[model samples]
Target: MIKNVIVGIDPGTTTAIAILDIEGKLLYLHSKRDWKREEIIKAILSFGRPIIIATDVNPPPKSVEKLASSFGCKIFYPEISFSVLEKQELVKAFVYKAKNEHEIDALAACVKAWKRYRSFFTRVSYLLSKKDASELFEEVIKKLLKEGKENVESIVEKMTRKREEPEERVEKPKEKGEKVLEEKEKKLEQAKKELEILTRVLSKRKAELLTYKRIKLSLEELEKCRKELEELKRANNILKRFERIRMKKFEPLVELESINSLELEKLDKLLGLENRVVYCNSLSNANVLNNFGIRALVTECEEEINVANLEFPVIKIEKEFIQDVDGVKCVKEDKLESLLAEVRKSGLIKWLENYRKRKENY
Candidate 1:
């Protein structure tokens, strides 16, 4: 007999009382400091039957319309405005994900101050229907400005009789004296081609005024050497901050002296060493301390590890001697000594135990 439809709320001092169920999910979200009128009529008499009470807290106070007319339910006011402040910020971000995110930011500032007090009758019925549609659009713009001033005075009296019939025609002074001597020889060949284009534009305006005075004296000597190199870089950054505050007040008296010995002469130069190896192999158990310090010895095979005398090679292994070597994947010597003690605790057995202690000290 599933019949429980409750949407009862009286949340004002800035709105909130949500109850929605007929599949509109949010079955209960109450606020106005958690209901009061007998816990909102015992949550609408425990939703046993009569429901539906959506009240964006409007003029609903004659004791909440006598408790929604003694609970027979049905009370829906819902017209808060400013688009209910984006539905009270999506109902205070989903009731601040179920409760107090600072009381859903103080119930979204009391539902934006109860939708600005129910937008004063929606702003006085939108300013009395915009003053009755602006006096019916100013009486249709004064009857289209009195029919555009009687069609602009009847097209200005028919363009004043075609301008007095082209000033009554006068002509023959002996055929205008040979058409005024061929229009004065065509105005003397257009004044001799405008005086040869004004003497080639005054010699290109005196060569662009001497290249605009040499680019305005090279932009005022590059703005006075950029203000004397910004005052010598602000006095060399205040003398490099007073020489870094006198080298931080004499850095512990120059790190307490002690520096005059000089004898560094071991120059068998491996020029800036980086994993170097050199071994012109006179194979005396060619270990080179099993691979970490040989820097040169190539009699040949060079291919550019900087050519001349190469010899790095020392990663040899060959011992736990079981030879089922054909693509060997055999394991058991107690799982190869627990996988070589987890590959010698992961430093890959320090270059195979320094190449088996340089082949057991040769």
Candidate 2:
């Protein structure tokens, strides 16, 4: 899914107002000299209400805030340094397709100025207080760039350099001026030795660099997994709390068969307002109850609570008045009671009981 974001900036003489999607896809580009803020804002809103509005202009004008507030969107103020190079790259790419030299020059100048500003900002930020990780990453990139440049230079030089091989001629032993074959052999051997040493050093360095990259990637993945695990643990704790509350509601229902008629009435009244109740005397009855909204209050017990209304299913008793069991839980009694009162007012419990009994054989 493409999430939407609208970026807006007050364009300077050389730069222009632009809007990009969340994926950094440019949607609208306009020169500041020709367009007003209202016009630009209107054009953007016409596409869709933006979830985020970004601006480099300081203390966003009241008019902009009012427009944003009307749409219930958030305004983001990203530092100006963030978008300068991005804008240049985008304009440069556009200008590359232009038909005229003037357009090309204009675009190139804009790109150059933006790049300089971006570099200055980056240098200042880096020098202010360099983060260990960021510094390491910068160092790695610089080393790689240096190595790449050196390799290209070396390849070019090799291709251009003239190579002279020894001329094949019959060896005529000269008395005084001829170099010995032993000297030539020694020179060749020395050259081979140096090449072998250089090759070995390069191979070792490459292996070490690969190992360092692997370790960095592994640490990043581990950190991501750790955060995910923490989120899961929090969710699990919430589920456990819910389970405990559910189990507690079941205890009264399980003891229903052992209690006297009066006690059963009290228990029924307590469980009814506190939770959705159900009665099941046999396995068939349990199945019938299960088909309804009720969940088992106690394992192997006939009684259950209605899952929808969180009330007990009605069991015919001598009393007509319904008692509230809101205070039965350990905590949040008031909140629970209030919720139950609201549910009762909605007539959901009565509807739930009738719906369940009619649908199921119980």
Candidate 3:
């Protein structure tokens, strides 16, 4: 049998649920400080099947929405639900002494839903039995809201017509000969029951066979994945043709770039510089660079600006600096060109190889 009731919820740190019947009578109103969603659902359903579910807030709380959806009922919402102050005022007439805020909010929502639909409920009750009317109310209001009164009247008229129609039937008298065949029919029924048992056993075996096939296919898929992994490793090995001699061949360039010294020497211990590279729009970033104990690679200095007593090597470069690309700073195309121009051929080749190794590592 379809039960008819309304449910309201206030979901929060303290969860509360309120239920009302078709006649606007309270069925249940309770709260839990620590609540579980499943228990809320269970409690709402335990009261009676919901005809309408409601909540007091706009953007109704997710837990409240979920409970309403699970109930599969018409949900009611006032154009704008009351504010906290308004709820206390509205609930005062019906509920004088509420235990807490959650209970008051919940009951207030239920009262609002009842007030909104009471007139409609009264007219529906007059049209049909209360049981029949409430069963149809969820459907009726949805259509009435979407279409209009005319559609709702048509639906009522159709239901009345179904109720008024008389059922008709005809029966043939049984013969004595039919009684004679009953014994044979009983034996045939017994044979059919045995056949059904065999059919069920066959179905179980077929399901087992399918399970075996799926297991075999899964094993094959895993084997294919292992082979693909091996192929990838071999591909990596094939591509690294110069891995054996890159370091030894990279030695001479170290000298080509060595004379580039005394960029800074015998300076003050600016304990504020070690470990991180800092970028600056201008040489003015020198103060920030000195304040923090980290590496500083300044970008806007066209000519070297050597400040006295500055211990850190705040190298100024004329090129774009790429952040953390394969473990090197300033590895962009322009930076590579500036490096080649400064260090000449041997160093350039070694730098190029290091960049390639970094790219491969990435």
Q: Which candidate comes out best when scored by lDDT?
A: 3
Give the per-residue lDDT of model 3 (tens digit) for 1-362.
Answer: 65567787888889888888878888888999888988887887787777677888886777666676776665666668678887977677657546788889888988888888787766766665643644565566555544546544566666656656796643334644576578779989999999999999999999999998999899899899887677666544422422322332210100011111131111112111244334444454354445445433445457555544343444445453433322223334344345435544544576699899999999
Question: Which pairs of residues collide in model 3?
Answer: 272-293, 273-293, 274-293, 274-294, 276-295
- Candidate 2 Cα errors over 4 Å, as ranges: 1-3, 11-16, 32-38, 61-63, 79-362
The digit string of per-residue lDDT tens for model 2 on 118-221 reads 44334433542333223232233233233444343333333223223355676567722346767777899999999999999999999999999999999999
Error of 1 at 199 (Å): 3.0
The alpha-carbon lDDT assigned to residue 125 of candidate 3 equals 61
Q: Give the candidates in order of lDDT, highest first.
A: 3, 2, 1
Residue 57 displacement in candidate 1 (angstroms) = 99
Model 2: lDDT equals 0.45
lDDT score of model 1? 0.42
Which whole-number lDDT from 0 to 100 does residue 203 have in model 1?
89
What is the TM-score of each predicted model, taking all chains together?
Answer: 0.19, 0.22, 0.41
Q: Is candidate 2 or candidate 3 better by lDDT?
A: 3
lDDT per model, in order? 0.42, 0.45, 0.62
Residue 187: error of model 2 in Å? 99
| C-alpha positional error of residue 55 in candidate 1 after TM-score superposition, expressed in Å | 99
Worst 10 contiguous positions by lDDT, candidate 2 = 316-325
